[model samples]
Target: MRSFVYARPETIDGAVSEMTAEPGAAYLAGGTTQVDLMKDEVLRPVRLVDITRLPLREVWSDGDALVVGALVSMEELAGHPVVTERLPLLREALLMGATPQLRHMATMGGNLLQRTRCRYFRDPSVPCNKREPGAGCGAIDGFHRTHAVLGTSAHCIATHPSDAAVALLALGAEVRVRGGEGERVVPLTDFYRLPGSTPHVETVLEHGELITHLEIPLLPRGARSGYLKVRDRASYEFALASVAAALVVEDGTIRRAHLALGGLGTVPWRVPRAEELLRDAAPGEESFAAAADAALAGAVARPDNGFKIELGRRAVVRMLSTLAKES
Candidate 1:
């Protein structure tokens, strides 16, 4: 076992202080992702600041928005009546994630912050820019079928691996965080950073900051929303291509639309072009196909992963078509 100091902080202030005091400390909630990486030695933190004991586990509401605590488990979030009724997209996304046991332990915050599942990043022997910056990316030219097609850099092409995040992004959620500077809310769409030059830096959050909660903003009432995940396996497998789609139709015209893709991009890929095409348009196969095409228009493809472009397009089209039928 690796050597590390452990601190179970009962308060948010104490958690932040412990994280700030140690330059190489990591916050531990569910340990679903952190522990796996630690076992692989991909992350070698000197200290672990456990934040599970904090009061950040409530599922409440603030007028129109739905507030979910950072420490709330995926299963809890998926099964909550509020989530099931108002945000079926999010509930479906959570249920489509890892197995029931992992979902029972995986926190909403940790799910959003989980690291990429790239083979190179998980294997210490391989050179991964995300795992060890400046070491060069092995997946760039090797075993790259699962790498990203959108929002990727020449340095790293690892795909973001969260099904729930796609739904959250599509639903226009905001991330609440506590840091040395105090509390702030960031649009979930703006929280993730593209792997440009620094593949190691995955988010806009600073070292001392902690994700406290997530809030999904109000959406059009009677909206039909859900997630569809296409994976290599039938169950308990990461998505090969997945879509989180929502639509509100009124008087034969598209009202509000929310769309995002997972397992196909460096971040939770929100396609504004697709959403733009969807807006004011009638529900039809042609519109769905066009919207899907627009979403994948600028996708860049590596050798083995080029199939994902067309696959992702089909997934988008299929998801929209299904949503249209329900509306």
Candidate 2:
């Protein structure tokens, strides 16, 4: 690993300042993902600004929404009373993301900002557009079974590997960021950038911008929500296809539904067409299958990963069916 200067900032402004002062500086919270990248030489920062000391670890309910500080650990969030009672989908996603040890150390902001788990991107020896722009993506035609099918580009096919992020996207979470220019609130849907041409640019966050907190709008009183993950293993593995779903069933008819997919797209994939199809429809196999089809309508898959298209549809149907039955 490359040696770098380290600074522990007590304030958000101090952290941002420290990051901006050095062009090759990165903010460190849990260091779960950052440390791994640094060890792999995939990310070589000249300076590391430790923001764990910053006062961004609170998790509270604000009016009808939940406001979670960026530094809150995944394990803590998963077990928090407010989260369990109000946002069960988020809790389930958090718990299923990693092992207990990793969940204890992974922070909310860090999870959302974590890079893709593509082998080509993580290994310095391989060419990856996300790791080094214009070098070419080695996974495009080589061992891309775990890569993305939706929101993919000719330059990159890496899947965004955050289960929590998929739940947050379905919940309509908003991110609060503080940077050199000051503070701003960005919708989670708009936070991620598609890997069209500039695959290296992943998010809307500018250099030295620090995510402070996340605001998730609470579900309706009668709404039921859950998360389902399918992977190679039962535990401590990334999802091959996952679904985060919330449904409000009133008098045997679905009134509102929100669905987001993970492990199948370049970003946390939200399917509005599927959600729309579920609205006012009865919770049955026909409706569920139709919604699933709508969700995977524009998916483009490669040879190895084409199964994900069907798997993603089944996940959507299964999650919605379960939530509908519970509601």
How close is each model in CA RMSD to the real structure?
0.9, 0.8
Give residue 83's lDDT in candidate 1 (0 to 100).
87
TM-score of 1: 0.98
Q: Model 1, range 1-327, lDDT digits (tens) per residue?
A: 389999998899999999999899999999988898898788999999989999988999889889999999999999998888889988898988989999999999999999998989999998998888899999987999888999998899999999999999998899999998899999998999999989899999999899999998766678888799988888888888999999998887788789999999999999988899999999888889999999898899988999999999999988888877883
Work out candidate 2's RMSD over C-alphas.
Answer: 0.8
lDDT of 2 by residue, 210-239 (tens): 999999999988789999999999968999
Q: Candidate 2, after superposition: displacement of residue 267 in Å?
A: 0.7
Tell me how far candidate 1 lies from the true structure as C-alpha RMSD in angstroms: 0.9
Instruction: Give the residue spans of candidate 2 off by over 4 A.
Output: none
Colliding pairs, model 2: none
What lDDT score belongs to each candidate, Candidate 1 first? 0.91, 0.93
Candidate 1: regions farther than 4 A off: none
- Error (Å) of candidate 2 at residue 233 is 0.7
